[model samples]
Target: MANLLSLFKTSGIFHLTPGMVIMWLISLTLIYLAISKQYEPLLLLPIGFGILVVNLPLADLMKPHEGLIWRFYHYGVQWEVIPPLIFLGIGALTDFGPLLARPGLIFLGAGAQAGVYVTFFAANAMGFSVNESATIGIIGGADGPTTIFLAAKLAPHMLGSCAVAAYSYMALVPIIQPPIMRLLTTREERVIRMKKLRKVGRLEKLLFPIISTIVIILLVPAAAPLMAMFMLGNLFREAKVVERLTNVAQNELLNIVTIFLGISVGATMNADNFLQAKIIFIFCLGLFAFCVSTAAGVLLAKLMNLFLKDKINPLLGAAGVSAVPMAARVVHKVGAQEDKKNYLLMYAMGPNVAGVIGTVIAAGIFSTILK
Candidate 1:
């Protein structure tokens, strides 16, 4: 009988807690969504697996003294390595052709970041430090890797929740952005038609990343690593000499890093750290940031229209959040509603990628000022 009692104490069943079970279920839900519904699988799959690992009874996924996940995290995230590496993949895939074809859209990217600062001050009001608030505000930019990079640098303690929120919301951009787009811009404004972009010369494409890196790095050297990696990838693509390197960077490299990043992020969501009042507040603030960003993009476009002889389809402004292809697609779709012939996908790409660059710049700013 005493031996039976001892066995029970050591059993996995006895070690389970309600919170663990709940988290396990949540993880499973994320996996299911990734599989069946096809929502952000590149990230959700690893995050779900990480959640499963961490929530298991006596699993030391986050045990600082010794944990597999924790060790991976220390090497991957805390050291500020993987996020910038992913930026290489992002840079590889990005065609700066659209952006170079239209330089004015750069301000739309910069203007959208107004939400980042607004959310930061508000977070400081709510008792978060400068770094923590800055991390929280970046959610509005809707660029996942930038959020991960910034949070890792400024507030590693909040990495798991902030990353999850950032990426999860990015995946939900279709749901979150449209409502804000409609609220901020009128149907007529959304219907405005943009002219075809000027054909970009291959030379301009090659020159863009080189010139941008020099200018932006001169302005904010802290952004050098991310901005440099991103520009190098663009240069590689434009050089037309390293096709294989570009392919690997765009696909396999991105995929592998995404899996590791997701799992590492999900592992950070253990009960003690995640189930807090601040987590809820983080979600709210992130949503606010996204909306404010969308509004800024639209409003800024309206301001630009005042001087320009040719009008821009204001709906494309929403693409300034930097979710890349997704936000660009959203702009195209919304524009098509007004006139099927008025597709804005290529034009939207300028702000789409610019948003990514803008977010990195904002992260550099926050890290510099706060740190």
Candidate 2:
């Protein structure tokens, strides 16, 4: 009887605590969102399942040096291997034609980075360390892999919270961006249409990745890992002879890494580390960062219209957040609402793609300064 009772005490049911229960609920919520809402299901599903696995009593899934999930976390995230590979896939999939046709839109992408700086100051004021503040601030950039990379390097303790905040805000881009965008721009500004983009030749497309890699790396060497992989992927796509490599990079390679990355990141969210006042603070600051980024992009576009002969729809500025195609789509949908004839998707893509580069550069700058 004594031995049986001792075994029972060691059982998961006997060991469960309020924190564990709460984390289970959180995990379930993430799973529900993934299945029902189709919100980043590829990532959220694996992450949510990981959360469930790690939180189970006596599972030890996140225990250092002994746990299966820990191996994933250590080799992929702690070693800093996954994020840059994700960037490689992004590069292969991206089309820089729109951005090349309108080089000035890069400013809009740059301006959107204001959110990162502003949130950094706010996080610091709220008593986070410089590293933590910077990690939290990068959530504004809306680049999930970049956010994770910076957090893993600078503030590993807060990696789970920062990553969750970044991805959650990214998934909610449509919800978060439109309100701020409308507040910042007039209906006329939203509906303003510009001239058509000029055609970009194959040579320019082929040279862009090479030139950009050289120039950007010369400016920020710390950014080389991500920049190199991103440019390499782009080169593979534009090379026209590397179809197999491009397909592998963009599809199979990305999918495999994403599963490992999501599960590993989620395992870090063990109840003890995740359910804290600081987590709440990080989430609130993340939303602020995202809103500020969207507004800054729109406002900068409005500002530029003052100097340019042809007017740019301020709505395109909202695409300056590095949420990629989602931010661009939001700009298009909002513009279409204001004027049914408005077709802003392609125009928005210029700043949208530029925003990806801006976020990476911003991460490089932060890593250099803080690390």
Candidate 3:
């Protein structure tokens, strides 16, 4: 009878806590969002499963050395191997043609980073440590890899929450951005179309990554790992002869790293660390940051229109967030709604890709100041 009682004591049922139950529920919600809503299924599915696994009673998935998930977290995320590699894949897939054709759009990308700074101050005022604030602020960039990299370096404890917040907001770009974009820009401004972009030559495409690598790295040395790998991947894409390398970087390599990255990031959200008032605050701050970024981009474009002869569609400005194709698609859709004849996808891609570079630089600035 005593042995039976001991067995019960050692079982998962006896070890369950309210926090674990809540985390499990949260994980289920994430899974629902992924499977049913089709929101970032590639990421949210693994992350939700990881959260459920970690919060399970006596699963030990997040236990130091013995845990399966813990090993992935330590070796992959903690060491910061996955984020930069993700950037490499992004670079391989990115087409710099639109950006090169419209160099002035870089300002739209830079302006969007206002949200990062604004959120940094807000988080600080809310009593988070400077490092924690910095980590949280990068969510404004809407670039999950950059958020993870900065959080891992500056505030490892907040890594999971920040990553989840960043990626969640990224998946919700279509929902969150349009309302703000519509609120900020007039229908006339949304319908405004600029001239077609100039064609970029092959030589220009080949030199861009090299020149950008030299200039950006010189200006922000801390951005080297991400920028270097990103530029190298772009070089592989532009070089044209390295089809195998480009394919691997964008496809196989990216897929493998994403699996490790998503699961590892999720494992960091153990109930004890995640289910708290602090996480609620983080989510709120992250949303504010994302909204502010969209607003900043649109407002900047409007301001620029006043000085320029050829006016740009303010909707395109919202694409400055580093959510890549999603933000761009949202901008394009909004513009299309204003004028069905309008096609802003390629135009939006200019700032959309520029926003990726802008985000990396912004993260480097945060890392430099905090570290």
Candidate 4:
């Protein structure tokens, strides 16, 4: 009987808790979303699998010094390597032409950041510490790597939940933004067409990274790690002389880092840290931040229309939340619902890319103040 009981004790099933089972279900749901709904699959699928992996009773995947995932998390995220690499890939894939074609659209990106600040105060008011509140606030920007980067700095405990929130909402941009876009604007406003953007030369595209790198890094020295790599990737793309380097950054390097980033982030969501009331609140606050950011962007575009002779499509403003092409594509789709002939995609990319910069800048600001 003693030997029998001892043998049972060694089995994972004997040690499993209800919370671990619950985490498994949650992780599986995420996997379903990634596989069936195709929602941020590149990250979510790995994240879900990681969650499942860590929750097994005796696996000890995230067990401090000895764990495999612990090493990945420590080196890739905690040491701040992966997020910058992710940004490098993002910069390589990005095109500044649309943003350069129309400089005024940058304001929409800046305007969308209202939610981040607003949520910072709201989260603080709800009894979270300043550091945790800042982590929660950044979810509104809808940039996963930035959220992870900030969470790793200000609130490492909340990194998994915060990252999941950011990516989940980013995937749901098509569902979330359209309702807010419609709520804020009249049908006439959605149909409004802006003037054609002027042509931007390759010189301007090449110069943007250099000028932006100098200006942004000067203003936010804390942003150097991310901003520097981001700009360098863009420079590689724009230079046209580093096709091999650019291709690797855009494809292989990005793919590898994304896998590490996703799994490492997911591994943090073990039942002990994740199954809390505060986690629920974090998700709620993330949704609130996303909604407010969407609203703020649309309203700002309306306000901008008041001053300018050439009107801007209010739908374009919805793209200012750093979900990249998805946010921009949603903006185009919403505008097309009003007028199929209207081509708002090119115009929307301006704010879409700008939002990426805005979110990164916001993360840098938070790191400076809170770190």
The whole-model lDDT of each prediction reads 0.85, 0.92, 0.92, 0.95
Q: How many residue pairs clash in each candidate?
A: 2, 0, 0, 0
Tens-digit lDDT string for candidate 2 (223-342) = 888899999999999998989999999999999999999999889898899999899999999889988999899999999999999899999999999998999999999999989898
Q: Using alpha carbons, what is the TM-score of model 4?
A: 0.99
Candidate that scores best on lDDT: 4
Against the hidden true structure, what lDDT does model 3 obtain? 0.92
What does candidate 4's lDDT look like per residue over 96-132, in tens digits? 8999999999999999998999999999999999999
Error of 1 at 351 (Å): 0.8
lDDT of 3 by residue, 2-22 (tens): 999999999999999999899
Pairs with backbone N, CA or C atoms under 3 Å apart (clashes), candidate 2 = none
Q: Candidate 4 regions off by >4 Å?
A: none
Which residue runs of candidate 2 sit more than 4 Å off their true CA positions? none
How well is each residue in 110-203 modelled by candidate 1, as lDDT tens digits?
8788888789988889999888999999998888888988888888878888887887888888887777777777777787877767889989
Models, CA RMSD each: 1.5, 0.8, 1.0, 0.8
Q: In model 2, state the lDDT of residue 300.
A: 94
Better of 2 and 3 by TM-score: 2
Q: Give the C-alpha miss distance for residue 195 in model 1, angstroms.
A: 1.7
TM-score of 3: 0.98
